[model samples]
Target: MMSTAHMASDSILAAATASMSIHSTSPNTTNSTESSISTPERPSGIDNCLIETASGRPVVPRRIVNPIAVAPMVDVTTSHFLHLCKIISPNYTLYTEMIHCNALVYHPDDLYNFFGEPWEGKVVQLGGSDPEAMAKAAKLVQDNGYKEVNVNVGCPSPRVQKGAFGAVLMKTPSSVVDIIQEMVKVGVIIPITVKCRIGVDNLDSYEYLYDFIKLVSTTTPVTHFVVHARKCWLKGLSPKQNRSVPPLKYEVVHLLAKDFPHLTITINGGFNTNEQIKEQLELVDGIMIGREVMDNPMFLAKVDAGYYNIPAEKIKSTEEVIEEFLEYVLTEHERGTPNSNAVVMAPLKMLYGGRRGKEYRRRLARAISPRTKSLPDIVRDVRLMMQEMDYGGVTTASEAEDNGGSESDSDSDLDAASHSASGCV
Candidate 1:
């Protein structure tokens, strides 16, 4: 459990969302029927726009008008990775990897050392049973410029279970309430929220969920609950399997929002298509998409242009985004403990998502191998390889362009598009 001192000291609020928005897509998309669809209006009796804390402190709603977020992947979604993703789609809200309360309150310097970045509008996901420890962790994040502190009661990993935190916390609402109270008491007042599963094992019942939400909401001003709309079978499934096998009862989550009008609820898990997000918006306050964003980063480009109704900018080629980020990474490396070349290459692989993606990843993996290739060597090798594949084995550039090839490739370009790291950034 968390100690009193930490919880009492960690409460806080936010400043503002840095000016960020998604870039645009091809022009033809805007003329399509799907493109003509309008974003639903914000809910009635719900100030669904950017909200304020109880103290009137500015709090941005978990709205992805950019409608795509970089999932809180653990190792794969660090601050550096988030910064990289921002270059591709700056409007996207980024999440911190799951921060264990033990690691957060005790080994904070070490925790921040690897994952920390001071982005003003970022969210911090925490794991712990002790209200005090969790509160302390929340405060640590608040002091560091994070916009929100979220309790991770949705991850079903055995390591997380063993620690009596993560998804397991869903089964203990009183504990969650205590943590929220401590965070509020300590002045870490930026919206404290929960990310959890519908239920655990065969114990899927509205009563369990109702009681859980009722207990916490009544006890503390926790207005946002990010529900991963799947049951987690504590006894039988691995975390990965748990994400899939359990049935998704989105209606149950919608009902939770209907039942508790004052609370803002967002649905997470298994959402891939924009149409799915559009349909979900009719029912919930926000939508959290995992893996999909990594697999197709440009997925939200259209959303920025359509749903949020902002005129989108041109989507930069992966090479362009990578080049800019590499400069940032190189500068950071020079100033501090440099990230391994492999660490840099991992996120870069997301750039190639379409038809030639497999070959692109293979080349990338090779370029960043411990036996390092020079920058010019990598650019020359990859460009030639992609160019060769584009030219039908003839190594012809004019022919590649004549084939209607897009310098900005699609999701079909990558061999494997799924992100392997846990949501950490």
Candidate 2:
């Protein structure tokens, strides 16, 4: 006999396939492009139309242009990393790491540490079960200029479970609704979304997943969801194990998208290539890539030109991208902001992944050692080392001008150094 979960899934899949077939045959739908997936008819007030603030200023619209987003990883998707990803792929949405509601409400002073330089198109992910707490956090997120606030209900870490949040909340759909309703009531103008697993522990059935999404969508204003496409064991499996041990059932997510065409559905988990992304885009509205992008940050360099059709001239070369990021770091360092070795080294690691990667990594690691004493010294040494190795055929900012590179390039380096000196005060 088929297991109950499999049976429910098969039934849902059949219905979803039938619905898709009907839609595919419609003349209006068949003529539309793959990028323009059809959403169900929403009430007029819910079409993501523009809304004005009380003071008469037009609020920034909450539009997701390309529909490709970076998944919110626990420790990896920091503000600096989000900015780096944006520098590589200008069109894709970026998400911050999962932040606790209490931290935002109680520790306002430390907020800057979590949020680096402000950039448009970044989403903030909040983890908490308290509706009031989430409401307060959403306002703080809005005030800080994040265009979207996502509720994290997909993390299966024991620490998150102990706090009565994360994947555990998947079992309690009503509470999730309360949290989202509170955020909407508190006047968050941007889109509020949820990130969740297909199921959690014993709730590993298609009906359970469907009911959860249905109830939340009907009861609240949230119309977007990023599904992880796997169930969480919630016990006996470590957080790392939870990520890999669960068998991925991407079809379930695709079926959900077909069944609820009105919702903006994005699938996350196990996607590594543009081909996989293209395949998923046919069934859903968006794709969210996680560890693969973090481990190989340059993977995003192809996203703008390849996926979004951004013109080649608009895309920066690897050398130009690194130089621009270093300029940002130098500015942060100059503002008496504590320098983060992780921030300084992230782009370097991404850049050194080419021909002489190992040697470049070894030398740059030595140059940025604790004894380097200052950000300027570290930048100077790394530039000299890269020039010596002809890494990526990149010349030092000064040497570039001397060798007939753009004058603007040399001026940028001088400006960065001057700011770095003033920051040492």
- List lDDT for all candidates, in order: 0.60, 0.66
Tens-digit lDDT string for candidate 2 (165-269): 999898777778778878877888888999998877756666567767876777777899999976676676677666666667887887677566667888998
* Model 1 residue 407 lDDT score: 36
Model 1 lDDT, full chain set:
0.60
Q: Which 10 successive residues of model 1 have the least lDDT summed?
A: 12-21
Question: Model 2, which residues run further than 4 Å from truth?
Answer: 1-63, 309-313, 393-425
In each prediction, how many residue pairs overlap at the backbone (N, C-alpha, C within less than 3 A)? 36, 0
Q: Candidate 1 lDDT, tens digit per residue, 1-425?
A: 23442233222101001111112322231222222111212223434344444423234344434434555766656666667767755666677677787787887665445565666546778888887888888888887667788888778787778888877777655577777888887889787878887766533555556556666666677877888777665666665566566656777787676666567778887786657777877677778876655555545554454455554335544445656776765655655644555554456665544356555666656555433544445545556555555523321111212221123332322212235544221
lDDT of 2: 0.66
